[model samples]
Target: MKSHIAALLLATSAVFPALAQTLAVKTSAPERYVVKKGDTLWDISSLYLNSPWKWPALWQWNPQINNPHLIYPGDVLSLHYDSEGNPRLSLAKGVRRLSPQVRVVSDKNQAIPTLPLAVMEPFMRFEQAMGESDFDQLPMVLGSNFNYKMNIEGHLLYVKGDLPRGGNYGIYRKGDAYRDPDNGAILAYESILVGTGRVVRTGNIEAGKPSTVKIESVRREVKPSDVLMPISSGQSYSANFKMTQPVQAISGNIIASSNKLREFSTMAVVVIDLGRKDDLHEGNVLAIHRQSPTVIEKESGPSYIEDASSLDKVITQVSEWFGEENDEDSVVWHMPKEQVGELMLFKVYDNISYAMVTKTRQPVRVGDSVSSR
Candidate 1:
């Protein structure tokens, strides 16, 4: 956990010099504010800057302090001008200690995240992709204590499969199959996040049954045969918001949206095909484009052509002479591609990544083109 925290701290180090020159400070921005629990960097930046995405530009890293990116409850932050008249946020002086113990325990050492942690916490905790065989092999609820087919919160459930003693698992039902929007290839099956259950007993598998789980939390109806997978424990929030251009132009389709929404708009979560393999990562912003409809030119008889044989003979002679045909072919003209939105990738997987819709001129939909900004 310490190393993970350190890695996140290191990620917040760099700032774009060009963005600093164009920093847009809010007219009504507060001069100073106190950090608090659950205060995201985006939230704080929005309070001061018109464009919250330009946060790194105005953040002043204090080399004198250790882990400058780690801001916590009680640390005071104030906006001030540097020697060159550029605006910068500075951390106010506070209690200091030499020992590592004090530094670790101090409020200032707690790292702040770039986005709201709550937005991604449920996904990180309950959502996972599994193969069909793996999903079938997972422990499942056999029946309810009351013999109810559908179970709700506080219900007792009997599960059958290999059991790990005293572990909590998320109740997942089979959801939609995610497919590549560009080529219609199946990507993976999305597990429905139902609820949570805690193992109460490890029944003997030799007798053809094992494990009993109690439904502790239910977002939807829990039922018999619901698969149980262990919940993950990790921080899903990020602290980096650097905007970078792709090394090469990239284009992909929005395969799916969060919660299986059919249509998307600003602030919606959309999944795209680009990933680490495509040089995409968290903190990269992508532009969404909508292509224009195809147009086909109407064909009419050539103005001076009277005989079909004469035209065919002329075309044959031209082909033989130039090794190419001089035939009147249909032509198509297309409208310019229009930029519809921008998305910031927050979570990345192997072949897919999840991004939040940051800005949009129109409602983003499935199959919309996503290109690098």
Candidate 2:
């Protein structure tokens, strides 16, 4: 019995030290820091903790008196140790700018955002997903005013279809279909927003009357082939962003990105296969793990080769020497996927979510899988 107790104590000591290592505070961490404008959650968290994503663990939340996630400029954060000997951070009340008329300002406006709003701007509120049939049903740009051969911003347009009076529409072109890499099943169709316009006059196709619209903005030249979708308004972005892990384990692949670049780094927009059905919500931080591009290991199924172009070049050279074309058979050692970066889910759909690459150790690519582990 004494031997068993001794072994148990040894195990307990080992486990606690590992836990402490994970929740380790950086040596350079500040004891107390004043929150300032233009500060991000990662920035402030990194000032006191080694892993910024583990910030909630360090936060000493007071459910009754404070909203731990909403910290504004001028707030004070102080480091303290809990009774259990784990490090914790406590927040002090902060102030915000008031209206000249003494009106109560919104807490979100004063609260520091989770990330730079500029990094998430285009992907958060602007992106829209639609079915292929819905894309087909949208009204097409009929022609431009004054019979101009090309259409640009601030030009008038004629559209033939049902349109609501005073509705704003985005002129779009169909983009790539996001498909699950595991099974070639399409998850969602991407709608690329190129231009926008406001309805000046509603139209009736049967009545032979076309709707009049004034183009307000254009990313690409407005064309007749583009489809019109209503500019979605309301609750697009959240200033009170909080980082939380998903309720359960999530495994999905990186299907697409907003910039269309093959290789991207921090602040790039990425789309994942997991979504509302997977119980993922906004501000959920996930690890982006991909197999190292330099190493490809033998596996039962196909290997996940990220940054394939570079990997292919390496394999091609090896093949030339060995006289074999297959890259998989050339490599025999196993390499587990390593965490290259982290992303925070900002927007979620029925079967997909939009995330910003918040941190990176290597350039991330489209085929890399993500985990909520």
Clashes of each: 1, 0
Model 1: CA > 4 A from native: 1-39, 43-54, 72-89, 92-111, 232-248, 293-331
- Highest lDDT: give the candidate number: 2
lDDT of 2 by residue, 1-373 (tens): 4454346435434634454446888888887776777788878887876557667667766442345567766666778888888888877446343448644423445678888887777766667776778777889888988677668988988998879889998888888898889889888889888898999989999999988889999898877767887876664557556676665777998998888999999988899999899988888889999975444444444444553457655775676589765654546334678998888888888888889898899999999989986
Range of the 10 consecutive residues with the lowest summed lDDT in candidate 1: 300-309
Best by TM-score: 2
- What's the alpha carbon RMSD for model 1? 9.2
List pairs with backbone clashes in candidate 2.
none
Tell me the lDDT of candidate 1: 0.71
